[model samples]
Target: MNLKTKLFGEVYQFGSVKEVLAKANEEKSGDKLAGIAAENALERIAAKEVLSQLTIADLRNNPVVDYDEDEVTRVIQDAVNEKIYNEVKNWTIADLREYIIGLDTGDLELKRISRGLTSEVIAGVTKLMSTLDLVHTAKKLEITATCNTTIGKKGTLATRLQPNHTTDDIEGIELSLYEGLSYGMGDAVLGLNPVDDSIDSVSRIYTLFDEVKNKWEIPTQTCVLAHVTTVMECIKRGVPVDLVFQSIAGSQKGNEAFGFNDKIIEEAYELALKEGTAFGPNVMYFETGQGSELSSDAHHGADQLVMEARCYGYAKKYNPYLVNTVVGFIGPEYLYNSKQVIRAGLEDHFMGKLTGISMGVDICHTNHMKTDANDLEILATLLGAAEVNYVIGVPGGDDIMLNYQTPSYQDDATLRSLFNRHPIKEFEEWMEKMGLIENGKYTERFGDASIFFGK
Candidate 1:
């Protein structure tokens, strides 16, 4: 495969697919920190030029991590359909880019071609795409998944109710959840990232979620975003878990840093199927971000975007009900500022959909980052326009437990209104039943958690 190009009479060469992918990426602090980023703007453009000419087969032949050494590589490679691969093996990354955004390529054609591509190829084309290119191409793919209810039905925008508490206080958590539900949120799943991961603490929270779901007959799913093993033990002890949650990385070593493996993940999924509450083949919910593999020292010299795409490929193996990137939560060391964060958010959402998973985003930023609520709003609007499956909804856009900021319950409510979208059909019907929404607009009763107090 050719990896040489000239920009303004200067020669630029990349040693491998890994180098080309890294250099072609738009500026990211993590890649710079890794000492792999292109030296200057001209070199970056040169890398993109060379990357666009590389064929799919070039990427397929050069897995970032060897298949023998990495289970993630093995899973992604083993899953490729040889017949589909052959049809597109000769296509350059540039051709794939135009074809994806071409007028003729809709969801059906994208889905069919997606069966042949690997995570590396996905990352390759992503490097050549503009910010708006990412958004427009993602608009054509409407991926969905089901657990208790379906998400991504074209007119629906769902949310994961993150009623987090710094102390894991039951009353505080319940109060936040009640407030969120009052705002017509939590249709995707009522999930909490608990301060405590002990089985008793998790069990108590799960019991509370179960009691509330039954008492109100709310048509939604519930989960406690604790460690996979903690939730596994909870399931064995009969805690009602609607979804099994895990924060996965693109590589096996990064997953090891998270203290689990494919074996552990597979076992957890099997246990959820046999003993958990959700009725579905899609039983897993995974959260990923750009810098995770690099943070864990498991990036294998690949850039964050390539590693991020590998996440979706790895996630597709289990047919997860939910797969979201907590985009800006990794901080400025990876994404830097608002411009970088927004770009990563769009790229992640598009790559996830292209990988054929139910894609959502936690359009978030840490305190130290050069971003604020306005940047979050901009990205959320773009994601809403792209018809994302869901986004994380926390009280006031601040995650007290995780100490980060994401979309608020009220922000998501406004997003639905702005986009002319509704929650999952069953949850919207439940909202109507509770008098929170009327004729697709909020009623006077909305935003009042007290309605649930007397009941």
Candidate 2:
């Protein structure tokens, strides 16, 4: 059996590419123009070879290939460009499935293909859904918490640090307190950053995981365990983990304390594979933003170079299971200008070359009351346009405390309406419109009963 048959079973094949193209052409046109256009598209699809043998040098050199970036920009621009002469066609679900199959079968060389193809695919899917009016109603959102022990301060609720709360305290509060807040409102994935404090970090993380797993019953797959400390702990514990470069800034100062060097990253992957755990780098968070004191533009450019180099190097060394990046606040400096935050995020994505990064582009500090609905909508749109895999945020950060004294938005339809109007609603709507339904449809499919009682 072929790869697709093996994965999708015998019922998977819908139609041949040629037949589907012919039908599409016939549905749209009585003139030869449609037929000619369909033929050209078919030819383009066939002419592009799917698979190619790659050398370490090819992977290393691709990031710096220095093609007119304008050319790349133009390709993507043309995909979205609306001029009559510059129109780009959209692909159907069938077409997308076939393309994914081609990639899976090693018929397409993923790395060599223009990143523009990814953009085109996303745009095509978005347009197709709009044209069909088949968009879903439920919205999906990802909320991540970043805890930095070194800073001596926990993050706010959404991006808040995991308190140095003891294992017991974490267990007592995490499931009943935070889980409801996260689940009652939106789709959430907690990101634990265990920086330097190994014993305490691992113990607390394991405890939190246990509470989430046993008490709340969160699936292991849904929870992302990101380790910013040593890789050996990850290996010893046999946990699928994301490796973050927390010590990069310190490394620049000739301090090895928290830095994740190339060797360590490589070792993490090798060990992960041996232990049957997925491993990927979280470089975008450490290298970009104010942490390095680089200007937003400069920081983005330099960070991309560094991420590409490291990602390419690692991919060359030992094909990673996945590639991931974090798009959150580097420090308090970003609070000064929200535009800078948006710019920094876009730049962070460009630096990563937008491939193999599973779950890229998370909002670092999005809880402040000053973060308007327009800004949130913009952030959602930007993340969607960039083809970012996921985004994380809290419904009420420091701004909207959800303690017993403070009323939760759950009961307030007015507050929920406020959320539904601007960025919150826009983000959810955009995801649904684009057919990214994983996060949003959780409640609809599972029902509220699962939250209170697992049945």
Candidate 3:
């Protein structure tokens, strides 16, 4: 089948799904986004085709995924269908397909993440290692991938600004940012979930942050997670719109609910390029998860992981700056347990990286999941090792407003210690000069841990 090139917008055809994406990854010149768009388009069409191979009977017969056996390697080796052999390969036909698709997407970073994840699955079923012991080994997988790098640039600790719901007044805004920056968590852009869709609320948060930024000289951009329409209004009203925020869904219909279609997305992107700072060329920020489609009943029967990857395809069109996969927040419907959540998180991070978008995660869970800080920590450590761009640094890992638990500044420190990663160089230099971080080391004396500012 033929698809339009993301760079030149020309139609190109590959005889098979594998060839389509394989060719795309090989093109390394001209506009890089075009190469990325080609890879994304490859995954989009490839996933749809892979999903078609499974019959109701096949899925029903293989419903239980946590079951362990070495049959996957056997199934991949034995499958005579050229399609399965070429584009699919391990745990079940579905997992096997996705694992291979991620590896094939021509992004070495994703391949590394997938390599780690599938190893755990294979070892679990193969009696090679107990699933309970599927820790640390995933850290062995590595890659040399780079994006515009929002919070944690490549090979460094990642950080972000998640100030509750960002419904605070100017004073509150300044204080919260001071707290995070004091802890060296401002390398990533400052992002907030606006309390409502009102353009006033959106403008107020942006204005407050901008004001605080100038007053305190905090080098960060701000995002009020208002609707795309609200952000568009902010742009027209001449308010500061640094990073365009929206909760994106896998299907077109799900996105339509938020007033974002191709036309609106393109328009918002063009506007942001002319306006936003601290990230783009592509300053749009998106939040996505696996169950969003099924939660909204727009999944169209595809697996949650693949469906979520499709959202990346949609996101690449606008060339987003940050796409956060809030892994465990959707409760137990799509990802039922920590195992599933961990796997899905890695898959989301992997797939997004493969599509050539600057990516990060909340590394979070809601009150309703079978996951917790321990589980989130395990995933965070591994994803950090995978060289993911960033994670949310909420105060003490508790979001009083969103009612979820995410990684804290302390956790960010642990990741930095574990991976030898610091914030991006600009922020890192600032930290060094301010004595928040001394000689590339974060000392306790940088700032008072409570109720005070640093630097």
Candidate 4:
């Protein structure tokens, strides 16, 4: 059978299948709607297998021997109360994959958020992932590797490093870091950030690249660098490079909220297109603790408004490879009503020209009281429900290196007693009663308790 037939067969959405295929075939020169619809149909079809593995009945049924139906009903209701909770709890990984595929094609936009840091941040990431076991648990997830480098004044690292540090020095660092990480975790996507604000900086970057061209492997890697005046210099010098666009927010208390000058953004977009570099602008960026409110004077919430306008304008003018938006610095509002915050951001990007958005969940400060694992889980659920792409904050060195240590974990006998309640025990006994065993055992996979209980 053909790809479409197989996908449709999996999803059991055969009726609209022909209509979808017909629409896909009837392509106009620049008709985006048709393309989006076709992509959506394909994703839904692809996700069928994973979705089949889940059932509301399985989740709703209590495993405890003496479980009270009333309590089980309440828990189920609570879980289903939120839109995201409702949509995701029953979704299989394949369903998620379909959603991701649709997101890639712009049928749906997935917003991914990640905290930013200098090269020193990697150590924090290592510690954080170790604590969470995030990578080992995630299956078939795409990991992207990225490195940020800067232009040094005169005799800085960018300019001074020679044969020992090739142009690929930055790339090499990123690869090495990723390799170390994946050895303990899984594979990831690799991207580079070479900051070129001046001719000298660009020259240094190119020189670095020249040293590593061909010697470096990893064909699937993607590059993200800036398109400054130095970009032209690199091109003239015939340096193999990929460009990435970034928006820098101005200082919080400074004269103005900083961002890419409009003309510069446009120029970079045009240049990257001309040179066939895989480039896209980083839309959402803000300083630590700076919330959603766009800065005034120089940086303002209006920046988001302007970014939306510019992205759509560019999409109309030129068919770029990808358009991305980022929603950075999730505030208390995100914690309180993460669903709403994510929904609004996704709506803005979906209504605009963005192909996808990155949702940032930065935890720069080391106040354990302020951020915790539960907070991270809430954010993860919200992102999953929003059906957007997002990045989790891998603890940075500054966060990990802090002298302050969180309080020691305490056992809660009260909580344990609550679980010992007859209803809870009955539920467990019932699961035992049902003989519903996976590999002849019942297991709990989520929550801290499950980790402790071996269930």
Name the best candidate (by TM-score): 1
**Better model by TM-score: candidate 2 vs candidate 4:** 2
> Residue-wise lDDT of candidate 3 within 59-90, one digit each (tens)?
22332121233222222223223343233332
Best by lDDT: 1
User: Each candidate: RMSD to true structure?
Assistant: 1.0, 17.6, 13.6, 22.8
What is the C-alpha local distance difference test score of candidate 1? 0.92
**Candidate 4 local lDDT, 95-202, one digit each (tens):** 433443334333222322111111111111111121112212121122221212111011110000111113435554434333222211101112233433555655
Ten-residue region with minimum lDDT total, candidate 4: 152-161
Better of 1 and 3 by TM-score: 1
Q: What TM-scores do the predictions have?
A: 0.99, 0.44, 0.69, 0.36
lDDT (C-alpha) at residue 5 in model 3: 33
C-alpha-based local distance difference test score of model 3: 0.59
After TM-score superposition, the amount by which residue 365's alpha carbon in candidate 2 deviates from its true location, in angstroms, is 3.8
Each prediction's number of clashing residue pairs: 0, 17, 7, 46
Name the runs in model 4 displaced over 4 angstroms: 1-176, 180-189, 192-216, 224-233, 248-262, 276-293, 296-370, 385-455
Instruction: Return the candidate ranking by lDDT, descending.
Output: 1, 3, 2, 4
Q: What overall lDDT goes with each candidate model?
A: 0.92, 0.31, 0.59, 0.28
Off by over 4 Å in 3: 1-152, 165-167, 277-279, 447-455
Indicate the TM-score of model 2. 0.44
